[model samples]
Target: MRNRRPVGIWLTTVLLSSGTLLLSALLAGFLAVVSFRHGWVRTSPLYGIIAFLLVSAIIGTLLSAFFSKKVLNPLIALIKATQQVAEGNFDVRLEPRSKGEVGELIRNFNRMAEELSHTEMLRSDFVNNISHEIRTPVAAIENCATLLISGQLSGAEQREYAEMIADGARRLSTLSRNVLSLSRLENQGIITERRRFRLDEQIRQAVVLLEPKWAEKRLELDIELSEVTYEGNPELMIQVWINLLENAIKFSNAGGPLIVRLSEAGGEALTTIEDRGVGMPEEVVGRIFEKFYQGNPSRAAEGNGLGLALVKRIVELSGGRVGVESRPGEGSRFSVSLPMENC
Candidate 1:
């Protein structure tokens, strides 16, 4: 009842096979007339020839159906599986028999479905994390506002309430900015415009910018560099360093040490930032690069959970890669590799 052909190759085979049989029968009849009727035994090979033609036609039709069905069976299965996938079933899989184009098609479809499933999971997780992140700060601000409105606070208490409000606002601002940065980094329209810059200088600038934050915690700084110059956007790479360092300072125990190292390893410029903090578990570290992923979701850290995600995206955009090594209670070390080119 679907407004399309039932199957294409089936019809083609039927038509071609039937036409071949009819043409062969006519040729045979003509040859019989030339050899038997005009030259030799004219008694009649007519009934015998008629029987042969009928049998040949039958065999040709059967063979055509047999060959055509072999192909049509897999084709129909593929079509049905695609329809199911379109109807929101990512679990449907096609098992094609032979290793043909059709088999490759099915394999690719399975992969696409798997990827879609993973992406959907990530999207759902992101939505939930974002909702929780927003709710906590908003609820805190609302509670503080409610206390002030109910006249339950003295002058000093009111000042404290105002400071709480300011703090919530700052957290929200940080969340919004990180979200925007992550979005921009993920946008396909944003491609890297590589240029030459000193990798050591970039790290120094990021450290300088974040010095006040780390200094307030009395965190000791360690630096080692090979004076590496690389081709990349210095500003974007600076953001990567800042985010990693800021995270280190935020999560590190007070007076702990932070190490920032830049060096050339195996023809690549590598920057590593290691912190002595409450590190992540191995399981969490496996998916650390995923967007909106937070190893600690207790809302303890002042982040929107996009910093590492942004760092990974920016590194990939610059023809580089990012990786993390961490274990719970020990610490985390994040490394990024970029091309070591003079441009």
Candidate 2:
């Protein structure tokens, strides 16, 4: 674990190891010749020639075995590891063998396997969560339909059942839309459409767009924005604000004040949304941006948990960063920093 300088050290090691093997072979051959001359090898001239051939054959066989163990064994291990991985056995890994590039390669392979294992675990958990979320709405709609078909409900009951069905359908539609958007952001490698736009005005529009939701909760707004133009994908950038603002409004306590701040800092446009809601613990804040990661299961019904993930993807695609500041019982602040266009 010391300073691993990849400066011809591995090559030097291979050369030294090969030199030792060559010296060993030469010593054995010299001993065979000396023995033959000293009658230590008691045999006729023709038999002596045969004895030398046997020694050479033994040496050749030993050399083959040595090379097979030193070089071919690691390669075989790698092939086996690859086969296991292809069959979804991410838990399989190989340890470092030599102090050379092969060693480094094995280390990287182990790390890759570890990451694949974790990703597989997360994917399974996410699929299960999605199934549960979708099943709830689907079951509701099915049950409502069945009840309506019975034709034993009053006019009010019929309307209520129909409304419940509509609500369930809407929830499913929202989930589908969010999942598709997040998928596109993550899986597609298309370049983002970029242009110069007034950053402060965009922030204002996001705030105004959610005016109804915030007003319904009797929340107060504290807006402080400055004029700054940023270069990025306008359409995607707008979703960032929408998600952040929606999150702020969603978690905020009734009648609490939400603070929005925009400023210029070190050649970047900084936007921060602070919500006086029930803040989360450190562990929850750390993983909130992960796909389908909801800090509070109690509030899971309100969202399908892809908004923050999409926000992160869009921000990174535009060469920016998103971060969070929060503590339990206090408020949470989500900050986005994007490079501003040279004016």
lDDT of every predicted structure (CA atoms): 0.80, 0.84
Q: All predictions: root-mean-square deviation over Cα?
A: 3.9, 7.5
Q: Which stretches of candidate 1 lie over 4 Å from their true place?
A: 1-17, 20-24, 27-46, 141-169, 187-198, 223-230, 263-270, 299-301, 321-330
| Candidate 2 wrong stretches, greater than 4 Å | 1-44, 98-105, 188-191
Which residue pairs show backbone clashes in model 2? none
Which ten contiguous residues of candidate 2 have the minimum total lDDT? 1-10
Q: What is the lDDT of residue 223 in candidate 1?
A: 88
lDDT per residue for candidate 1 within 1-343, as digits (tens), equals: 2334446755776777778678768766766666676656555778646755777667766776677677677877777777777777778877757578878887888898888888787778877877877887788899999999999789999999988888888888888888777877777544467678888888898898998999999999998877987877777888899889999888888899899888887889888999988898888888767777777877455677788888888888877888888878888899888866554
Scanning candidate 1 in windows of ten residues, the lowest lDDT window is 1-10
lDDT digits (tens) for residues 207-239 of candidate 2:
999989999999999999999888777888899
